[model samples]
Target: MLQIKHFSLRFSLYGKGLEQRDLEVISSLDVDIKAGELVSIIGSSGSGKSLLAHAVLGILPANAHLSGELYYQGQALTKKALEKLRGREIALIPQSVTYLDPTMKVGKQVMGVRHDAADVEAVFRRYKLPASVMDKYPFELSGGMARRILVSAAVIAGAKLIIADEPTPGLSETLAKEALAHLRELADMGCGVMLITHDITLALEVSDRISIFYSGLTLETALRRDFEDGGRSLRHPYTRALWKALPQNDFSPLPGFQPYAGTVTEQCAFFPRCTMATEECLHPIPMRDLRDGKVRCIHAA
Candidate 1:
């Protein structure tokens, strides 16, 4: 129930000697999540994944300038609209557990301003959180328990769209799978879920579609099935490279690094490292439909 079109984000910062420059962080990012669908955004640490979540929640810093359009449930997500929807119809499961209030009890925090203890208790029970854990402080809960509480808070709020940002980091493999399963369950229950993470293997397990993000741009959006057979069905070269690098695959390390944000131009960002790059790749590349998926590379066929 969310649509992001031609989205771009940049920060205006003062440079040396009274000069100002704009550092573009996200450019031409296009993604859409339908009800009961889970879309995973796979990217590296600096790919602006978390920034997109913040932008959806209207929590970006004041200096940030946003372009293009964002929509929820077929309506434009203007600043005023976001103010009305944030934390009510939309919720964020942040990257850090520190978002929990250290001073507040777990139950109260989940209840939020709604103050519906029964709702909190019901959600806690669904997640298998014991009643005693509610009275405890944040530091008293284990990592998995804390994660369940965060998910519980979103459920209690009746959020229609959940943006889970890097939810599996610092957890054991089992715990990580458990967390992802919960998100999958939510999507099955008619909630739109956006999973922003770097682990492609874990994402492939539960995602209905996968968006390959790099250097703040989405290079490809492919179905989960497209990753089969060494990603031969995948549309973008960057996506295929990622698949080959997986340990279960070729495990071949790609040369060079992703271009740093703000340094990316309209040309293909992967051109520097792409083996098939030609002088034609120096021109602007727009995302296009290809074989039931979307890819940014003009050479994709």
Candidate 2:
């Protein structure tokens, strides 16, 4: 159970002999994860999906700045409180396992999570990881193997919520499927899972609720069935583009480029590339609660 209200993260870049320029990666974004729900966050490459995860976990970079109310299980998370809860209550599986220590054995690294022997072994086996993996170091494992290690570590920490950022990246199709299966299993066991990914296929397969984000804002949120049934019922140019880009029979790619940070005006962010753009698109778009879910675009009702 996590709630982010008006959450925003900003960064500043400095040039030689110049003052720093502010860049907003996520602007007034809000999202919630209920207990035991697996939510998939999908977006193009620069959509700030990872940034949102980092901000929630209190793992954002030093130069960056963040503001907003992040509540966990009805408790407000401040700077100090978040530090204590990050690894224990809120586990993060970063995009890459390449950062895993090469020096330590896998089991040793995992055992460092305040968990019991039985729990660790059970989770490892549930993911179909072998007992032999524990004795090996990071270099000895394959990409999929390392990903599993990270997953194991996250779940073993007794975390109430797990934030996985591109968990299936760099894996083959079969491995990706297996990894998603493992994530679903975690959700089934009462851990709220947030699977942040750019891959539409993986998102659809593993998510209960899918949230489409673009230009640091949530375009739409809907059930997995909404996506499977042609997704045409779901509107929003960016959402349409994403669904079309999926490998399907009637796919028609959306023309033009993805939205960039700070480049968007108060007008419709997708208007430049959206064929449906009209004079009414000049107004600021806000998230409206449709009967099915929430959508930001004015035309997507």
Candidate 3:
């Protein structure tokens, strides 16, 4: 339903009023979501996960410049096309509950001005939200309630593709799982779902495929099953490191830190911390197909 190829986002900042420099936030990002699949983008805080979300929804800041191709249903997705689809065919469940309007009642916001009351009530029931909660204002709702309400909004939008940014944050474990399950259900119903999250465990639970984002680059895109058995089938070293770091896995520690996004380099983004790095890694790395998935590392055989 959607494709983003060689996507990059750059911000122009002026240091001394006239001295301008470009800070590339997202580079060489490639993501594809099919009609009946849920793809999770897993990364740390500054890995440009949220930026990718904003870029897709055409909500990036005015100062930001984007390069790459975005497509929906095989046609070019331009700014005007995106505007037409923003809240209708493409919807967002933002990470912050503050995305909700404090002035509007929850039901009216979810169902829209011309939408049916029955649709709102049905979505509320799906999320286990009570009927009484519909009349409540955004400020009156609790965090968990608000998160569910966001889920309610996205599902009610009946969007062909849904971008859910960290939807499970701050929720109870049960609630988190329930929310992911709901997203999975959306994919099952033929709605492409792009789930942006930091919680790898939560992502593994519901995503059909997982894309690892690191330092504004996509390290790997592997199937959920590839994450099994210490990520043996996974191609990228970073992805394997992430899998082994999980409590249920090897539970080992990886040294070093993710480099800053502004740190310019020619080698692979993971080169500095990669144990298997050699002199060949000093060159720019290109994403290549490995096994059944894709990895950005050239050394992954």
Candidate 4:
């Protein structure tokens, strides 16, 4: 299980001349994933979904600064803890196939430190990957095969928590579903899975809960069922708009764009585009429990 509380990430960047400024990319993100549960983080590109994954894995750049806390199975995910947990108790299925080594054979990479060929072969078989794929290079494998291999690596590690960052992009619909199914299977087998993706519709089919992220903040975290019936049960305005925007729903487009990262104000990030925005929305909004879910909008009822 994993818990992220009041998590924020910022980078110290140099501006014109010697001026140094902080660019906040993630703010007040709160999410928890329990064993046998799959939580999907839905947001647009550059919403810091992938960055959250990197932060948890302790792979962020040197200039990056973090606030708040990350806990795994009731323990703080300190740098020392991360060093021990990374790729062992916790594993990442990265966004790109580029995470695979071109020089190393697929089997060797998937085997990892355990180097258990039998375990690797069994996992490969479960994904319908041929035995011959073990001897193939990363370049030689198809995109779908490569994706399954990434999942296999996590399986081989016997990780308790799996962070899958944008794992379905660049694959066919069938392959994408296949990839998601693998993650679903993992969660069913008692693994905590965090699926970071932009496709809310696709995610809804597999996620137990959905966290609606925008402009570097999570506006709402609701159960998948709340997204039903035109999202009438959804709390946040942005969340309902996203549901309506889906082709299977109203397909109605929201009027404005998400604010750029680092441009977020202390006030509600959705204030500019929210039709329901009041003068009160000009102040900071904190996430609070509502109907067994969580929403950052004060007006939500």
Each model's lDDT comes to 0.93, 0.83, 0.90, 0.93
TM-score of each: 0.98, 0.94, 0.97, 0.98
lDDT of each residue in 32-143, candidate 1, tens digit only:
9999999999999988989999999999999999999899999999999999999999999888889999999998899889758787888899999998888999999999
| TM-score-superior candidate, 1 or 3 | 1
Q: List the candidate 1 regions with Cα displacement exceeding 4 Å.
A: none
Tell me model 4's lDDT, rounded to 2 decimals.
0.93
Model 2 residue 241 CA deviation in Å: 2.4
Candidate no. 2 TM-score: 0.94
3 or 4: which has the higher TM-score? 4
CA RMSD of each candidate after superposition: 1.0, 1.6, 1.2, 0.9
Name the lDDT value of residue 49 in candidate 4: 87
Clashes, model 4: 0
lDDT of 4 by residue, 1-301 (tens): 7999999999999999999999999987999999999999999998888999999999999999999989999999999999999999899999999999999999999988776888889989998999899999999999999999999999889899999999999999999999999999999999999999999878999999999889888899999999876689999999999999999998999998998768988789999999999999999899999997999998999
Q: What is the lDDT of residue 216 in candidate 2?
A: 80
lDDT of 4 at 52: 97
